[model samples]
Target: MVKRTALYVTLVAGAFVSVFPYLLVALTALKTPRQLSGTEPWEPGLPPTFANLDRVMHSGFAGYLGNTLLMTAALTAGQLVFTTFAAYAFARLRFRGRDVLFWLYVATMMVPSAVTMIPLFLIMRELHLVNTWWGLLAPYLLGTPYGIFLMRQFFRALPAGLEDAARIDGAGPLTILLRIVLPLSRPALGTLAIITVISSWNNFMWPLIITSGDDTRVVTVGIAGLKGSIGVDPNQMTAAALIALVPMVAVFVAFQRYIVRSVVLTGLK
Candidate 1:
């Protein structure tokens, strides 16, 4: 009983640590600027107001939200399609130097984006993709090395009997991949999709470098601008931040079961 009590206490403490920041941010969003800037950070008194949220929305938050959603959805879909195909080939298909090529791909992950930022920017400039949504979406769509690696690991863990049986029944590689492997790999793919969406939605550095105008500015970058323009308006900033978190939170909550299972499988493998 003591051990169980200790374990429960630890778990509850951990949960509180994870959730407390979000709770603070949520409540701050409801506060007025005066309350937020005052000495006491935790005191509660007045009724919550939506004026901050209203101000954020009127200040082009809607446009930023739309741009972020579009980019995130596009990047996630592209990663899912491209990573799954590449992972399947690496896992099931025999080819010359496949392991070498896969290792090289993984090696790129070790190379920080900062190292290649200049080159990537110059390439985008040459391609006339800078300051556009295509600029934001292009790098991610080509199949991220990490996404490929994760999918490959998941694919490798799948039973080979399914593929062999499909091949004996006159199924081509493409047919088998589509009809067999993909359906069984939904959990991993869903997890990857969720991860991809969140990463793309929250990406700041690349978007800041590539985009400038209102036409392509995403939520994170937009929030930075909001900060500069609002200048210490904590309530407004908090409201915008809270709003920015909504889509990713909704996606995670909706697919949480699959995400948990995928994480467990990935770790076990």
Candidate 2:
């Protein structure tokens, strides 16, 4: 009883800690410019208003949001399709030097993104891909090592009996993968999709560098522009930040079950 009570207390405390900053941001977004600029940053001074949201939306935020959504959706889909196939091949198929190839792919993950930034930029420039959505998504759409690794782990956990049974029934490799493995691996796939969307949506550095104009600007870079334009308008910035967070929060809520299942499965093996 004591242990259970202590565990509950810890969980509640952790939840509070996680939620407090968002609460502060919510309160600040509701404040007037004057209230936000005043000395007490924590104190709620007025009733919530939608003025800040209105201001942000009017300031080209709609375009940015659209661009972000498109980029995230495309990147997530591309990552899942490519990574799933690659992971399935690595996990199930026998090939020449397969282990060596997979290890080499995993080794690439050890190299930090910063190390490859200049080379990637040069390649993009050469291909005239800079300042385009293609440029922004090029690196991610190629299938991330981490995504491949995670999918491979999940696929490895699956029973080979299903694949064997499908083969005995004259199902081809692609048929088995599509009808059997993918259907059973929905939880892992959902988790990957969520992670990919979140990462691509919130991507800042690469997009900031690659996309030079309004035609390709994503939300994170657009938010930075908003910060620069508004300068000291904390209310506006807070509202914009909240707007940026909504989609990801909605996604998490929608896929909460799959996300939990994925984590539990991953932990088990």
Candidate 3:
């Protein structure tokens, strides 16, 4: 009884700690400047204001949101396709040097993104992809080492007996992969899609450096631009942040079961 009570207390405390900042941001977004500057600044107003939201909607944030949505959708779809195939090949195919090659690719995951940022930027510049939609999507649309590794892990966890049975019935590799393996991988696929969407949606540094203007700016970069030369408005900045946060929350709510299933099933087989 005592241990269970302690566990519940700890969980409640952790949830509060995690949610407090977002709750503060929500309250700030609803406040007017006077309310924001008041002694009870964090308190919710009697009737929350929408001025910050209205301002943000008119301030090119809508365009940024659109760009983020498009980029995230494309990036997620492309990653799912590429990673599925690559991971399947790695997990099932018996090509020579396959293990060696997979390990070599996975090894690249150890290197931080910061270390490769400049090199990637230069390559984009050389290809004249900078400041274009292609530049925005090119780097990640092909998928990541991490994505391939993740899908491979889940693929390897699948029962081999089913695949062997399919093969005995004269099913080719592609046919077996499409008809048998993929249907069983819904949880892993959903988890990867959500991860890719969230990652692409919140990507900042690559989008910031690769694109020079608002034409290609995503939500994260747009939110950063909400700052003013003189000072930042607590209400407007928080409002923009809240707007950016909504889609991610919705995604988690929708696919949360897949995430839970993947965590439970992966890395054991």
Candidate 4:
């Protein structure tokens, strides 16, 4: 009984440590500037107001939101398409030096993005894509070695009998993959899509360094600007930060079951 009580206590403590900061931010959004400055950072404001949220709504928040959504959706879709095709070929197709090429590609994951950021920036500049949405999306548009490796692991885990049975029924490789392999892989796909969305949505450095104007400014960068030209309004910044979290939170909540399921299945595989 004592051990069980201690375990529950530990879990509750851990949960509070993880979530309390966001709760503080959410409370700050409800406060007025005076209340935000006067009260403790995490204290819930009495008689909360929506003025900060209203102010943020009117201050180009919609534009930033739209830009973020577009970039995230485009990057995630492109990555999934390219990653899926490449992973399938790696897992199933026979070709010369296939293993060598795949391992070489996977090796790129070890190279830090910071190391390559400058060169990527120079390449974007050479192509005249700087200050453009395309530039913001360019660095990571085609997925990563990590993503390919993840999908490849999932693909390789599938039974060969499935493919062989389809082949016996006159199904081409493409048809077999599309009909059989993909349907069974929904959990992995959902998990990958969720991961891609979160990564793209939260990405800051490349977007910050590449795009300079409001035209291509993503929500992550746009919210940072709120700390400066918006008169450093803590209430507005808090509100914008809360607004920024909604989509990713919604996505994780919606797909959390699939994520857990995928994790378990992948472990078993």
Candidate 5:
């Protein structure tokens, strides 16, 4: 009984430690300037203020949020299409040099994106895609090495009897994939969607380097600009950051079970 109590205490303590910073930020974002300057760091304002949220919403943060949403959706759709097809082929289709090709493709995952960033930029510049939406999306839209590897593993682990039965029913490869494989792989797909959304939404460096115009600027870079630009207050900055964090939090809340289930099914630590 004592050990169980201690374990619950530890878990509660750890959760509080993890959540305390965000709680502070929320408090700060809602406090009036006078209250914020005068009060203890952890103290809540006598009454909360919405002026920070109003200011941030008016400062073109909405545009950045829209851009991020569009980019995330496009990247997620493209990733699902390419990753699903490629993973299915690698797992099910018998082709010459298949193993060799898959391993060679997987080897690219070891090569850090920073190493290739400059070369990729130069190619984009040569093609006159710099400062364009296409430039931002083109590099990642095809799918990622990690995404391919994850889906491929899940596909390979599926029951072969299902595929064999489908084949006997005159189902072509596409039919089998669409009707049997994909429907059964919903958990893995949901996991990939969450991963793609989080990565694309949080990506800052690549978007900052690739595009300079506000027209294509993402929320991550926009949040950084809130910090550096003249006359932007800390409360507003915190508010903008909190706004950006809400969607991701919502996504995880909705699909968290899929992520846990996929991890268990894929045997990933």
Candidate 6:
């Protein structure tokens, strides 16, 4: 009884610790400009105001938000399609040097992506893709080794008997993979999609460097541009941050079950 009580207390403490900073930030967003003039960001600006939200919404936030959602949707779909296929090949197919190749590819993940930015930029320039959505998405559309690795792990954990049964029923490789493997991989796929959307939506540096003009700028870049020589307004900045956070929170809420399922099932293996 004591141990169970301790566990519950620990979980509650952890949740509070994790959630408090964001709660503070959200509260700050609700502050009046006069309230924000003082020191200490941790102070909960009580008796919230909606003026900051109204201000931010008028400040190109809707366009920025739309661009982020559109880009994220495209990036997530592309990543899932490519990574699912690549993961299936790695997890289930027989080929010479397959394991070695997969590991070698995954090793690249250990290398910082910052190191490759210059080369990628050059490639985009040569392809005339610079400052375009094509350039913005080029590096990520094929997905990453991490995505492949994640899906491969899930695929590997699936029952072989399922595939065997499909084969015995005269299903081809494509049919088995599409009709059987993918249907059973909802948890993993949902996790991947959510991850892809969040990562793509929050991506800042790449979009900042590669994109230009009002049409191309995403939410993260737009949020960063919210302040400048005029100095940062606590209310405005926090309000924009809160706006940026909404999509991610919604996505996590929507896919949390699948994320939990993936963790539980994958951990057991």
**How many steric clashes between backbone atoms does each model show?**
0, 0, 0, 0, 0, 0
In candidate 4, list every pair of residues with a backbone clash: none
Least accurate stretch of 10 residues (summed lDDT) in model 3? Answer: 260-269
Model 4 Cα lDDT, one tens digit per residue, 1-269: 99999999999999999999889879999998788888998788888999988899899988999989999999999888888889899999999999999999999988988998899899999999999978888777777887788788899989999999999999998998899999988878877888788889999989999999878888999888887753687788889999999888898888888667656644665
Q: Write candidate 5's Cα lDDT for 1-269 as tens digits.
A: 99999999999999999988888888888988899899987998879988888898899999999999999999999999999999999989999999999999999989988998999999999999999999999999999888888899999889999999999999999999999999998978989988898899999888988999889999999988887546867787888888898888898889888767767755762
lDDT tens readout by residue for model 3, 128-234: 99999998999899878988988899888889999999999999999999999999988789889988888898899999999878888998998888889998888
**TM-score, candidate number 1:** 0.92
Total clashes in model 1, counting residue pairs 3 or more apart in sequence or in different chains: 0
Which residue pairs collide, candidate 3? none
**How close to the true structure is residue 125 of candidate 6, measured as C-alpha lDDT?**
94
Q: What is candidate 5's TM-score against the reference? A: 0.93
Model 3 regions more than 4 Å off:
none
lDDT per residue for candidate 6 within 131-169, as digits (tens), equals 898999889999899889889999999999999998999
* Local accuracy of candidate 1 as per-residue lDDT tens digits, 113-226: 889888989999999999987887888897988888888888899899988898899999999999998999888888888788778988999999999999899999988886
For candidate 4, the lDDT comes to: 0.87
Best by lDDT: 5
Off by over 4 Å in 6: 1-10, 38-46, 261-268
Per-model lDDT: 0.86, 0.87, 0.89, 0.87, 0.90, 0.87
Give the C-alpha miss distance for residue 119 in model 6, angstroms: 1.4
Q: Total backbone clashes of model 4?
A: 0
Question: Which candidate, 1 or 5, would have the higher lDDT against the true structure?
Answer: 5
Off by over 4 Å in 4: 229-231, 261-268
Estimate the Cα RMSD of every predicted model relative to the unseen true structure: 1.9, 2.0, 1.5, 1.8, 1.8, 2.3
Per-model TM-score, in order, reads: 0.92, 0.91, 0.95, 0.94, 0.93, 0.90
